[model samples]
Target chain A: MKAALRNPVDFSQFPDANGHFDRYGGRFVAETLMEALHELNEAWRDCRNDPEFLAELDADLAHYVGRPSPLYYAERWSRQLGGARIYLKREDLNHTGAHKINNTVGQALLAKRMGKTRLIAETGAGQHGVASATVAARLGMECVVYMGAEDIQRQALNVYRMRLLGATVQPVTSGSRTLKDALNEALRDWVANVDNTFYMIGTVAGPHPYPLMVREFQAVIGREAREQMLSEYNVLPDALVACVGGGSNAIGLFHPFLNDSEVAIYGVEAAGSGIDTGRHAATLCAGQPGVLHGNRTYLLNDEHGQITETHSVSAGLDYPGVGPEHAWLKDIGRAQYVAITDDEALQGFHDLTRAEGIIPALESSHALAYVTKLAPTMRPDQSIVVNLSGRGDKDIYTVAALEGIQL
Target chain B: MNRITHRFQELRRAGRKVLIPYITAGDPHPELTVPMLHALVAAGADIIELGVPFSDPMADGPVIQKACERALAQGMTPRRVLELVREFRQIDAQTPLVLMGYLNPIERMGHAAFVAAARDAGVDGVLTVDLPPEEAAEPIELMSAAGIAPIFLVAPTSSVERIRRTAQLAQGYLYYVSLKGVTGSAALNVAEVAEKLATIRACTDLPLGVGFGIKDPPTAAAVARIADAVVVGSALVAKMHELADDPERMRREVAAQLAAMRQAMDQAGMPTAFAG
Candidate 1:
């Protein structure tokens, strides 16, 4: 039925004035960061609307980060499944080999316009760290990235890439020694040095303007996908699928299609081991509403409200908290959240590489894993577009270690 | 009246500056926390800030962060904290105990339930580090209704507008983060704090307590000369950590430090600008 366009509620008006999407998202930092957040919010507002500022961003997106990544139809994979036709939104093709560079470039431009000379970021898989380092190097700004000590070991390749790009990678030894710890350290750095540093958050999380700002920057993904679908394929896909760690890439794709009633949105979270085993990063799938890392969102916490340690084969999807928008989307039934176990995700990783000659990032493999199940449930006439958020080159070590193959 | 307000008023009438010492609940050992509180009161704490250990304390430096780790390792939760407060109330009911921590644990405990439980446990005030005044309306209302004061923090980066807004919502007292960084950070500048307090004083008449980097007694005395209260946290917590294997020594040493600050603050009296 063509009845999808009847309701047409505007999804762009989110985060109200207070940076809240209904009950989620708010300024939940120390007072030291309140004014800094307010300043960043105002600057983001001005830069997002200013023609010259946007022009610079667009030029950089074109010449520097390589935007408008191809939308490829997965013919062989779809026919083999004997279900819905599948397409891949190739964010993996972007510079730095991931979708993370899109938001980093935009935030870097804003930081330059705001006269900030230092950039600080936190990373899990180190893609965002590398992306932040790349932009800071290009803009002649000093960059420092906080990474978990464990991740510094797991993602040594990206860590070396970041250092090679002239960014200092500070190892965080606090908390669970992963992405969440890295973020806490980064926030501490921001609080201590709020005067001159711009915190370039890589995901659609954090305080007020960040979830909104990162979403807008990443919306270029959905915008391009929408245009390509209309101009090339003549219709929107029946559903959209993307991995949700902090829900950056997923929200980027889902935000543009929120008003499109017929398009089903599925946010895939990493269920390390399995949800029933009480070890997973499937926040929206298993968590309750709570605040952490500067914003209120769905978080994996114990009965005492302490954030639980999460396990995931994919480092990027190992966060205890998902973005507030994803929480709101799940609560409002705008998007369906599902989880893929490590074994299933590994299978999806191998399946994509063997069938499509594309070794998807372990993070993106979670989405492809969901697509493998959901595509077969739909008709052959239907279509699905999965965001291949990053390439798997960074995950080669992890995959090889798992397969017991020496490099 | 709330115990916090009453205590501050009594201190003001006595021409004595308030000394608030913070210690993480369940640190070193959960059994030692109540005894520690008593020792602090005997030493000269007009009000006490009990630190609720959170797994992730973003606003704390290495000192308090490690303190929280030790406490949480001993199985400290919001409920356990209230139980500790209840036990402390059993012996000492005069000293106003303020529960200080991040907001997630309380949010998990539910605002209404946490407030009521806190009130019943004899807690006088609550200072959630991450919850600023703008997002504090619900908690403020709940805490006020429960006769517990909702404390707020004012930072060096806080503008006049934010100070005014926070002043309106703050109950009992205002916690002025004396420096721009987290707790246990280096070097407290008294001149800078005094200048910022003057700006904050114009916004509200709430009692202003200076924290973050008030290390030794001399620094405490310097802060006491300008602020209504002096809150010593990291230095005291660090001392507790050093003597964790021996609870009695830890309590005695912590008491000595607080006693020294109390003596220095008494000698310094109150700030002339804020003197009645």
Candidate 2:
């Protein structure tokens, strides 16, 4: 038997012909909306390579969403951990208070460029809903956000925020009444309104163009962090860390650093309870490779091959499956994946709020927990950069309620 | 026995209700799969449905998807699952084995190649969950050439026209999904199922296998009273997940469950055990 030769392009050229990222990402959508996705793919391909489009996006990121969010050197926390000097990329400082706004702004602009008049989005924790609504408000485009009924109750403030921004929030009461259900409802909605509605997905999970497109939009975090670190520290940070739910934040922090052989990337998944307890959201750490929600990726499931309910303190990170690109990254050994329990994240959340006076989102606290672990073992000269993906205002009340502490 | 047909005929003649337990290969760990299969057979499973894990299993609820994830994580593949069947044939040649999965993986492996491989692997039947009977011609013909029964699913939502179409190509027995939603969902409404079974029975004399939401011995027994086979998947798969690390314990628990169901079915008025 003859061996087939392998392709030589890097991860950027991936999802080749068949929509596979090393047999991971592919179109697993219904037949009805394949044409819309294909059209989106064609538009994205043309727009991504256009200098004018790139320039416009760059300007939007810089002036609109406030890109190049500062790299704050955490000296006190660094000294307390005793591992290495730690720098935080303040994506949480962005206009919408999270990295989600970056992708939503870019996507909304692209939708306008493609002549889309209306926008639809599916949200789990409602961060993306708020971000999408912000973009729609800015662009004067009609917006509808589909969120699971369960999520609407848990994140009522975000739902209110979306409505305040002129976007209609539709609560989906199907299936588990969570992210997956909202996604299914959104897909159905897209199929029904495929002609004019631009479905703006929240993360890098879904089918082909989504994982690639969202990653590209979020990649700005890593690109800016790398340049900033090089200019300030005169070297690439020893390790780059971020939380992985649907993996958009982690992929954003890791994508630009992928070509840097010397830089190590770490993705911290939420271990709601613990991996052994079978109640965690550590898809890459504890899950198996499978297909769900349009992409082949690591998923937490059971013996009959069914997807199980995932647990995490952060509503944003509570999912059973992860982006296929994360699977490809794990396969290629470009990224190291780890998990932090809810307790650890909560502790980190408290530590950051007290020490830095920065309330970090519960999802971003997972990365902070990793930093707490990584800092203790690093050399004094080595620096670690953590992508602080979002602010913690939305999570403070929930965390305080869990701890039985009043603000 | 002439394999599936003969097994069904023998079951009918003996007035026995068949017990089918589903298990995803390579779950918990890939290496224990063959042993688990042998154990399932020993545990009172009349026929085994080996599920091939696919990424997008839309028909499955959470339990089955989790099982697929575990199996796929252990690097389970169609070829590997077939090898498990072949290895099981070494000790138990009479037990019928069915490969249940979606069509994409088989299509990826090429239909012709898959049929040949499945046959070589000692597979007797194939059930593609998402493929309708109208589009099942190519794969069904290929499997028929290999003497493998191609099982089809009939739902409560299935019109008489759809049932007639599915029955035309369906061999072995008709698999009637008792619920409107995915597998492992709510319990089967026996009355509704009985009506649907009657509708299906009106069309063909081929044995009817009732599955989806038939969880416990009582449900299985109730289903046995009206159907040829009671296919219990989620319940069995749940046991596998619970006993993933201990194959011996899994075998004992699963076998005991099946035996209890078998006994329940026997008491429910089957003429004999293992009847079609």
Candidate 3:
């Protein structure tokens, strides 16, 4: 049976006045950073609408980042599913080999306009670190990235890549020694250097301006995909699928099509073992709403409000909190969120590699895993677009090691 | 009168500066926490700031962060820390005790409920690390109604407008983060702090308590000479961290450091809260 597609609906104005998407996503930082957030919000509000800023961003997106990343029809994978036709939005072709650069370029430009000379960011998989470093190098600014020591050991290739781009990767050995701890270090750095440094938050999380600002910057993915679908098949995708870590790529792809009631959206989270067994990053699915890293969102925390350690095979998806806007979306029934276990996502990696001859980042495999379940249930005429967020070259070693082969 | 106001008002009448010391409620060892509070008072502390262990303490540096980790390892909760505070109040009733921590635990307990529990726990005040004045209206009002002074931090990076707002909302002494870095990082600069305090002084008549990077007696004395109070945490917590195996030695060593800093402040002609 096919799902009904409703007609187009008007986009609702959210995050009103105070940057809140409903009851979530407000500014909950220290007093010292209140001034800085205000400054960034004002600068972003002015630049987001300005012709000069948008032109520079557009020019850079076209010439520098190689924008309009092709929407490739995964013909072989579609045949293997024997159901809905699947198309891949190739965000992996972007500079830095991931969708992260889309927002970094815009934020680096904003940092320049704000007159900040330094950039700081936190990374778990080092994808965002590489993107941040690339933009910082392009802008000729000093860049420092905080990564958990445990992550630095796993993502050694990206650590080296970030350093090659003239950026410093600081290892955070505190707490769980992962993305959450790295974010704590980054927040501490921002509080101390609030005068001159700009914190380039990688995901659509953090305080007020960051969620809204990063979403707007990365929204180009969905905007381009929407037009390309019309230009190619003359129809909107029946369903859109993307992985949600801190949910930057997912939100980017989902934001533009939010008002299209006909388009069904799904966000896949990395459930390391599984949600019922605990130790998963499926905040929206299993976790409760709480405050972490300056925003009220669904978080994986213990009974005493202590943020619990999260586990995921994909370093990029190993966060305890999801983006606040996703929380609002979940509550308002605009999109659906699901969790895919490590074994399922690993199967996704293998299937995509063999079928489409395209290796996806482990983070992207979660989305692919969901599509396997989703695609088989739909008709051949129905189509689905999956945001292939990044390439899997970084995960080759991890895959080999998991098979007991030393690379 | 409330303990914080009474302590400050008594200091003003006596023409003396205030000296406060900070220690994590469960650091080194959970059982030793209330004992250390008593020892700090015995070492001439006019007020105390008890740190509530949080999972992610963004404002703290390495030492204090490690301290929180050790505290959490011993299974410290807001309710347990309140029990410890209640036990400490059994022996000492005069020295003002302020609970300092992040906003999550209190948010979990709800604004009205947490404020009421804190007042019942013999807590004199509360300073939530991440709750700025702009977002602190409800908590401030609840604390005020509960008779628990709502404290706030004013950093050197704060604008005059922010300082004014913080001072207006803050009921107890204003915590002046003497340096731009976290609690345990950076070196203290007296001249820069003095300059910033001049701007803060113009904004409010609230007693200013200087903290961050004040590790030694001389630095504590220097800040005491210029500001109304000196609050030291990381250095003292580091000492407790070093003597983790021996709670008595950690207590004695930490108390000794506080005593020496207090003597240095007095030797520099800064009167104690009880002296003129």
Candidate 4:
């Protein structure tokens, strides 16, 4: 029985003309990038509804990026939880092994239409860098990825993979020498080369258009899941869950279901040591409202306006800020955010691999770990959909190191 | 007229380019900041940009990053930076001082509170690196009510329409980033900077002070040729980093660097007045 009786929530009302959602998300970039952002906003507004542009985007998404990834019902894993049925949205099955390509492909096409000859991005775990590099290669455009020197050392395989894909992996060695530093460096590069280069931001973070734009691109996950759920199960799931690093994957899975009043959504943040210990990247759960990386969202900072260092077993989930829309959602109580420790995520990594023969990315494992707790509490007839954001091949080294065994 | 406009006007009447030197408050040590301000004035700095030490300075290079780190470690807060300004105002009320940094510190303190505190501390202007014009309404209004000139940055990549918007929104002189990169970057292309300044000048009568690559005396002189003011930051901040263990040498060396640039700018001020 699909009990659906509620007032509909309008989707178009949010992120007003200035790109703000009530109080969150705005064009908070340097002045040099204002015109470029305005141009991008105009181009996106024009292309979003244009039939020809939509045709091109849809064609690329289907033929090139492999859209409408399967929604697999994890029967064995669902039985193990013993409370609710579980379905995994297989974003890992997409080309480049993650949901990140969905956005990189969309933005690269926009970049092409805008006459941009090069694509540049910043990546922490190298997932986005690879995705951006893959799209740039497909578009016959030059690509450069700014990665922190530390991340390059940590994610050596991904660095090699990016280089093999014909992208220049520039190492940034400033500040804490991680994703934030790489992001700063990438912004510098974009400002310097705004004439020829397009900054294909990997997440639903950054300034105004990016948070809105990336969510629109990645919303394919939720849109497909919505149709698949109705066609296969005859009902929308009781809940949707995904990990929230910069909240790209989570936002993608949650956006389409936003107006569906009964479908609950949850965002799991990485609690490295613990939220109480202040070492985690759970910005929404533990942070205050402040500005960083172009938007005023939740931030992990000290008494002064300095960004604080964050820790996580998964490099992809270690950023200090979450997406601005997520902040708005959290504040308005549309979504609930919880933190899962590194050990808990690691347990999730082993459990899914052993039970369902799925090697989920450490980032996706965070989402799985949350569902592990949440699913067991729900009724047996109820079900939940968790976005399996990526594969775990990138985490072999970090997982091995956790057990004191070098990979 | 505001202190910033009046100072620029005074410099214009004297046929000399304005020299603005920047130092992170509480960098090296908090106690030395007041003396550093006085020394900068003595070294011919027409205006001073007191960096409100922030933890994450994205637009800055290594030099300002370390300076912010040291200042933060020493427990420098926005209020402390304001206190330092109050102290500087005690000795010298003539030279204008601008508070500069990312917006988090100010946002942490309410915008109205920060503006009021700045006004009370005799801060004539402010330059928030990350506060773009589109998102600057409330802060601009607060600053305007407090008679604090809200400074804005105009990068080389800024379009003419963008500059016009900045000109309408901005209260003080525009801070022109000479190059596309962060502070302490390589030397800028003079012709390119001159071309951008011309586009900017067409938008407003506001004075433009160029920084972010003017590291040495010649570069300062070169930028001073095409702009009304020459602003230097990372070069002097780098000196403070090198002399962290020795406060006397830090002050002396930083002052010497500013003095050289000031002398160079003053010498090159009249010949090339915003012209090719």
In terms of lDDT, the best-performing candidate is 1
Q: List where candidate 3 sits over 4 angstroms from the true fold.
A: A1-12, B269-276
Per-residue lDDT of model 2, residues A1-407, tens digit only: 11112313365667676467886887765333445667788889898989999999999999989977999998888888887899999999999899999899889878998899999998988899999999999989999998989888888789899999999999976456777767766775675567788999989998778999999999999889999998987899999999999999989989887767678889999998898998889999987786667777787766434467778888899888899989988988889999999999999999988888899999999999999988888899999999999999998778978989996
CA lDDT scores, all candidates in order: 0.94, 0.83, 0.91, 0.90
DockQ of each: 0.87, 0.04, 0.68, 0.62
Docking class of 4: medium
lDDT of 3 at B47: 96
RMSD values for the candidates in order, in angstroms, are: 1.9, 11.5, 2.9, 2.7
- lDDT (Cα, 0-100) at A219 in candidate 2: 91
Task: Give the per-residue lDDT of model 4 (tens digit) for B118-232.
Answer: 9999999999998998788999999998899999999877878778988998877999988877788888899999998988898999899898888899988888889999888
Q: Can you tell me the CAPRI class of model 1?
A: high
User: DockQ: which candidate is best?
Assistant: 1
Show model 4 residue runs off by greater than 4 Å: A1-9, B270-276
Candidate 2's displacement at residue A238, Å, is 0.3
Candidate order (DockQ): 1, 3, 4, 2
Across A1-407, the per-residue lDDT of candidate 1 in tens digits comes to 34435654467778899899999999899999999999999999999899999999999999888888999999999998889999999999999999999999999999998999999999999999999999999998999999999999999999999999999999999989999999999999999999999999999999999999999999999999998999998999999999999999999998899888889999999999999999899999999999999999999999999999999999999999989999999998999999999999999999999999999999999999999999999999899999999999999999999999989
lDDT for A284 in candidate 2 is: 95
Native contacts kept, each candidate: 0.86, 0.00, 0.68, 0.65
TM-score of each: 0.98, 0.65, 0.96, 0.95
Model 1 lDDT per residue over B25-135, tens place? 998789998889899999999999999999899999999999898889989889999999999999987899999999999999999999999999999999999998889
Model 3 interface CAPRI class: medium
Rank order (by lDDT, best first): 1, 3, 4, 2
